[model samples]
Target: MTKGGDEQLVGSSSADTAASSTSDVGLVDETKSKGNTTNSTTDPEVDQPEVKKGEVPRGPGPFFYIGGANGAGLVSVYCRSKGWQRIHDNKREDYKLKWCETKSRETYYNFKEGEQLLYQIPNNKVLTTKIGLLSSLREYERVMNKISTNLNPKHVEIPDPKVAAVMNPLVWVKASEKFSQRILKMEDFFPESFRLDIKDEKEAFFELYKDTQIWICKPTCSNQGRGIFLLKNQAAVKSLQARLQSIEEDPVYKKLPYKAPQARVVQRYIQKPLLLEGKKFDVRSYFLIACTVPYVLFFGHGYVRLTCTRYDATSDDLTAHLTNQYMQKKNPLYSQLKEETVWRMERFNSYVNDKFRQAKGLPKDWVFTVFTKRMQQIMMQCFLAVKSKLECKRGYFDLIGCDFLVDENFKVWLLEMNANPALHTNCAVLQDVIPTVVNETLDLVLEIFNKSLKGQRIVPLQTLCHFVLLHNGGA
Candidate 1:
């Protein structure tokens, strides 16, 4: 039917994207420092440094370090390619900045009080958080209320210390409160969820969700598919009784020091999920915040993940319900479902756009429009959930990952927000995308860090990731 329609709408090189998407909150084009950005549309290969035809990238001024082997290999390769050195002991090199998953006193080596990383306040230099705020969002319900009280989008307010905690499944009550306050009311997006603590509470929520078609029980603070299960009805909730009996049998776990909230959130399950080839899918989004409140950069391209097997509500198997990549990869169909397993958002657009437009009710760009708006709202709410407790002095930067589930009606729902998501480029699609974003994110960080050092306003550089100002409270 067509002679020469562009077959590769989404396959352009990262360079093309970097050049075309040079937007910033304020000031000059954030893409390049002078006439350095290349706009020519060459055969798309994510070019190898400046060797591939683009202008030479600026030299990395400060050396960096990576702790906790999460993304060390990839960062090592990047460090070598850019002629940047990675230091082992901070004392061994003039370590300007470093990345680590956990915030320990040991992680702050060689840096004085003012040095930056991700840490709690009272620091002279900006520091990043070690826990759930790789992207630096944690919900201090009390503090959140205060931030909203004196809310000035044009000015930053020093938040007071109010019993602080970052978002996890445990804060459904607070999330519910905020969702109900919104004009459109998205309270239904998040299913009815409640915490089960002390023996008496379990039976209450069990009765609460007793009539729901399905329910899911999740641990308050855990990762990598641990202690998660799906329950279809009252009979299924009864099965948890056996597990609770076991926990009661052993008090050792309760004795562990600095324990996370020993709570479980039971949420009503979405019986009708939007599926691809009958498999449940969820979109993943990422953000990095290295600056003060209201100012953060959003990555433009995030990907989608699909379940290995078709979603079967009746199936007893865990893989059919939980779409966690760490768990889904173990399913035997994971290999056979390679293309169906993960997708670049651009690939998703090319595939879904025309098909979605074939119908008359929804707009052609609904994904970019409605879908994106929903995402931004969720991200902003999440940030507000913990804004007051987050320390955003100089030198503090973080990367965060969020997951969302869309129902059959294309209604997006926030599944969970995570800090310090595993940075290893393990998936096939990740080999190309992960390293590129990591590199670009680092550059943006450097740009800000250098600017902050010289008392200059920080402007975001062109992004492989989209940078959106969720809110802008001037400092």
Candidate 2:
């Protein structure tokens, strides 16, 4: 679809967005009483002995535990700032908050909701995994299509005006017309993707392949641009199929603890991408699911990552096509050109304003306005797609790194969502962004947790920092 089509859809759908926003606030209020039911509810007060107002309520010193090396230092520092002690033991279940890069079932089993906080939902793979996301989007699209079809026009005579108002399809359609118009179509943002592991999806991909088009094959769960390649013709597709078949047929491989990387996906590649200074790049944004029970979600800004080499549609080098920090680091001159590989969103906006604003007839500060809202809407749709299936609790929270690619036409496309996104402060831009992200994340977590525990409001958050609230699901 054209960019104009997307705008029209967004404009029409947005007609009901204001009403939806009002309803969301109403939902929080309506669920507040239900939210304070302790064990059975989302934001129940923990059972604690009453203490005098002047006397400091004391327990276990409000201890916190850090589980992995991803962002341990920053987390520890943040905990210290809150006057919370850090426990080195991973097995302990007494910690008030636990932030781990890797999910642990034991920790979750012992988690004390309403009294503690945990990072990451246990079943986040539904949105994190490549194949998992694709499946969810496809299923959501099918369901939405069915609903739309059922709402189609049908003629029926009614004896009474009130009965007609209640039973007539036109009445129902008029009521939901704006809402139906405001939603995003799955194909509008997500690229055409097929799971190679599924026989039917694989065959469909093969049938859809053409010599003129480029398809990118990727491992479903792998990150850092690993195990990715381009399929330019029939030969590459057949070769990949043979390799997968061989891996599956290898009984010897099955006996081992680790299996071969047979679970893969082939996505239609964006041939003409919006390049910055002639180098391919992608925006790395964030989706924060801060609270699961009465879900609270936010969108945060992130820096852009560019390839080390210039754009080349027919380039044999993968570095030119993949705009990831890990891919860029592999180049021999990376050490000298590292500064050029990353750009802060402000810098990026300035560059675009200077170069393409008038030429493309874009609005002033288009990055902060149009592009930012577009990314948030896409993320909201993705969350709504898998919201019900996600495992939720009072304490569980998650932050997902969402990557997006803009075509030459300025249309945004969601590439993938990554759980436990890279927090390395290796580059100058990262050094400035990652720390703020971590600090603000903790600030919001603590603020909301305290309010929720005290049966207060989760909206009107004071420590939102750079985060924008996307969904306020009652707590």
Q: What global local distance difference test value does model 2 have?
A: 0.74
Give a tens-digit lDDT track for model 2, residues 369-444.
9999999999988887888777777888887899999898899999999877776667778778988898888888
The residue pairs found clashing in candidate 2 are 13-182
Task: Tell me the tens digit of each residue's lDDT in model 1 across 366-453.
Answer: 6667777888777666565455444445656666666778887778887766555545444667666666666766666656566666
lDDT of each: 0.53, 0.74
Model 2, runs deviating above 4 Å: 1-59, 155-162, 165-170, 252-262
Q: lDDT at 259 for candidate 2?
A: 51
Off by over 4 Å in 1: 1-62, 90-94, 108-188, 198-201, 245-262, 293-295, 358-360, 460-465, 472-475
**lDDT of candidate 2 at residue 442, scale 0 to 100:** 82
What's the residue-level lDDT of 247 in candidate 1? 68
